[model samples]
Target: MANAYVLVINSGSSSLKFAVIDSQSGDAVLSGLGECFGMSNPTMNWKYAGTKYDVSITGGGDHHKLAIKRLVEIINEYGLAEQVTAVGHRIVHGGEKFTKTIRINEEILAEIIKLSDLAPLHNPAGAKGIEAAIEAFPTLPQFAVFDTAFHQTMPSKAFTCTISNELYKEHGIRRYGFHGTSHYFVSREAAKVIDKPIEESSFISVHLGNGASVCAIKDGQSVDTSMGFTPLAGLMMGTRCGDIDPGIIEFLMKKGWTQEQIFSELNKNSGFLGVSGLTSDARGILEAMEEGHKGATLAFQVFTYRVAKYIASYMVTLDSLDAIIFTGGIGENALPIRREILKYLKIFGYKENEAANADARFGARGIITEDGTPVAMVIPTNEEFVIAQQSAALL
Candidate 1:
């Protein structure tokens, strides 16, 4: 089983990320990204044996077949292709239908097609990747891990919207939180970090990156999450507006804004970029703030405040806060932001070990809080490992 490798794939609208993991240790044997499909300059950038290489793909089209074909070549070149026993995919939305990871079959793929209405942007891409993987590795078993599966345990009160029950029952309109794989991996790891059994631990897992969400986990199940029906309805993000008044959309439409125009701005131009009139990145925000740019300063404030506020709000959902699991790019590395957010949670009596927080970064993992009651940690998320691990379980 140690030689059984799982090839994990995360398919997007125009790109796919692949990683080969040693299911035994969850260590990546190879990882790479294929991007710009259906374009003239389609390319694949990959890392292997501590070296990076960039090369143009053979074909350019909307289909991922050519891109994945190239990845197969890379795998074979390294002489590890034969050991690859299965494939895993990171599916963004599974809706109310799928509650856990499952091996993909023809029927399962068709059901994923039906649920495309819920994740119109992601599920189709995942399906395409699945189809491509089948074409590339005809004999390999395939597994799909849904980002919303772990949150399936959320109670109706947490997932239901204020809209009429008729709409929810008819249209399936309700909250289905995302980032379940990361939330699951980190929450359990967090329990171990603090030396508590996962089944007895309560946590608020904050996955902060370009797309951010907070999940309240009580005794190993998600009870509530900040992200609602879509990823757009949570804390401020790199490019998304997160939560906003429904009236704003109506107001903008009344002000001669097209639906496309309004949504594009909300989903693309807003967040840190909209507020700061600068790049939507933490490093950029920090740099400009140090340079006395008021816009960046304001953006920083809004980002930290909203995240802290959400963390505080999730406390009400859990029985008792065991530790706040911080993961993702910004969550793990953004020291100042993490520190400021911890300051906001001071009311909970979590002693922020300033020295420890600064030390735990750039793939470093540990409890950032001092030895005490309520703990906060910086556990770098490994969604791929979780994908590979879950896929291995099915074997």
Candidate 2:
């Protein structure tokens, strides 16, 4: 019999990323994306094994169904449909109920839907994908690999709030970290980079991108992370305001703005976009800085300073730092940003190796640190692959 394949689906507010891999070997046989989900002219691109294919929708509304339908058609066309044994979903929030990848049934689906308020931008989309996939493959088992699973190891002291226990228990409010799949996979990669066993390695992973977070991983486990309660608390992101004062919202509300208006501004209008007052794109910030834009320069400085400070704090969490790894978009490719952040934390023995940081082509894994300090490396995160591996193991 042909080896079973697992289809990994990651649904975002605006896109759907899918990967199909051999369940026994965890090797991706196909990877693709569906973009502009709710917009006109939605597009689906797929690469199966080695060949590539594309499809377009002239009028787009709900992309979850269309994307899955297109992906299934591609699989069938390649004669790989029957080989798909399982479907793995990259769910953003599993809350406290699911600590690991679990089989998705009606009960599991209901639980995930219950947590929609916690991940408003992600959970509904993920649920849609899950529902669509289950409908397409009625006989196949489905798995939910939560992004919050890896951080479940964080101790109470680190994840708990100073708020009353009654409020916490009553509202289910706590630090349920995201990007766990990325952090989990990258922490393992960092261990390999340092030639040390995962159980002994201590490191901080900075996942800087459109949505950024820093995770302190010790002994291959998450000790603490920057994101708290929501993705809106962390490093400055493309559009989301991270680590802003709570009073700001209160003040804005008192000035006549509603809760939804304040939320829309903070989660969609702020961050690099608000700070720069130009654009949210990191590359655009760099270009503006080069052109002597004061806002961009100040925004970049603030962004890097907060990142450096968090790295220092996370180092304390680890107690003995072995490496400071960078993953995600800006973390992996923005050499200048990485170098600047390292320079700001020079007091913490963090130094940049200009030559190493300048080598942008090393997308897999490589060091960017001076001698004697904890290793600083860029390990490109493959969260979908991690979900696929976890799902394969469960089956």
Candidate 3:
């Protein structure tokens, strides 16, 4: 098994990211992305050793199966297919059935499919990736590493919604946090950086990517999180509206808006894009703000304000905070965003080291607080490594 590899697949709505990691060292032997799936001209971009390649796939552009088959072909071309010992998939939503990493089998496949309704845009595509992996390497063991599993330790008080008992008890409607893999990885890293055992440390992990969420970790367990029931309930995200007035939905319904229209608007048109009427990428918004764009400036203010408020709210749940970690795209980069957030958090005795904050970006890990009470850090997340490690352990 030392010579074998664990292939990790992360299937997104319009992209497929696959990596072949050395099972023993957990280093990526090869990694690539198949992007723009379901589009007319889909492209494949990958890197090996020190070289990079990008090309358009001819016809296999609209399906996960085709994208995966192309990935297997690339692996075979490099003579690395024979070294694959197992396949690990990143499943976004597991409902309540999958509380931890599990081996993929017929029954498990059925359950993953049944859970698709809970995550229409994610689970279905993940299931398809699993099926394709099975077809591509029938002899290899396949595992499902769920994003929701890490936050399953959250107590009921943190997850329970104030809706009808029937809605929650009958249907599984409660806060099921997303980005658990990133949060879990960063929290452990934070504990290590401070030279403390994770099981005895407390952390507030902020994963601020296109999709954002904050988790309150007490003694290394998730006590509460920002995202609820669905990923749309947390902090304002790239395109999704977070924590909005419930009455707005009912009002839109009364105005003759269809459910499909409302759903599309909330999930696809809201958030930074809706607020700015421009783009969802934070880099673009920040650049626009520099150019005196009012909408971009307002969007930036609202986004940081909401994130600061959530971080402050979670502080109440932790008896003693060990550190506050920032990961994901915006969290790792976007120094302006970090500065604005810490400004609102000054009441908590947090003071940012301007030079350190500006220096940390795109995988540079460091502390950004100036000898603060609760340490503030910028640690880039490695979710693929977590998946690979879990898969190898199961094997």
- Among these predictions, the greatest TM-score belongs to 1
RMSD of 3: 1.5
Runs of candidate 2 with Cα error greater than 4 angstroms are 1-4, 22-27, 49-52, 58-62, 360-362
Query: Against the true structure, what is each candidate's TM-score?
Result: 0.98, 0.95, 0.97
In candidate 3, how many Å is residue 139 off?
0.8
Q: On residues 56-141, what C-alpha lDDT tens digit does candidate 1 reach at each position?
A: 88743554888888888889999988899999999998988889889999999999988899888899999999999998999999
Using TM-score as the yardstick, the better of models 1 and 2 is: 1
Ranking by TM-score: 1, 3, 2
Model 1 TM-score?
Answer: 0.98
User: What C-alpha lDDT, on a 0 to 100 scale, does residue 117 get in candidate 1?
Assistant: 90
Model 2, 248-304: lDDT tens digits are 988998899999999999988898899999999999999999999999998899899
The CA lDDT of each predicted structure is 0.91, 0.87, 0.91
Positional deviation of residue 28's Cα in model 2 after best superposition, in angstroms: 3.8
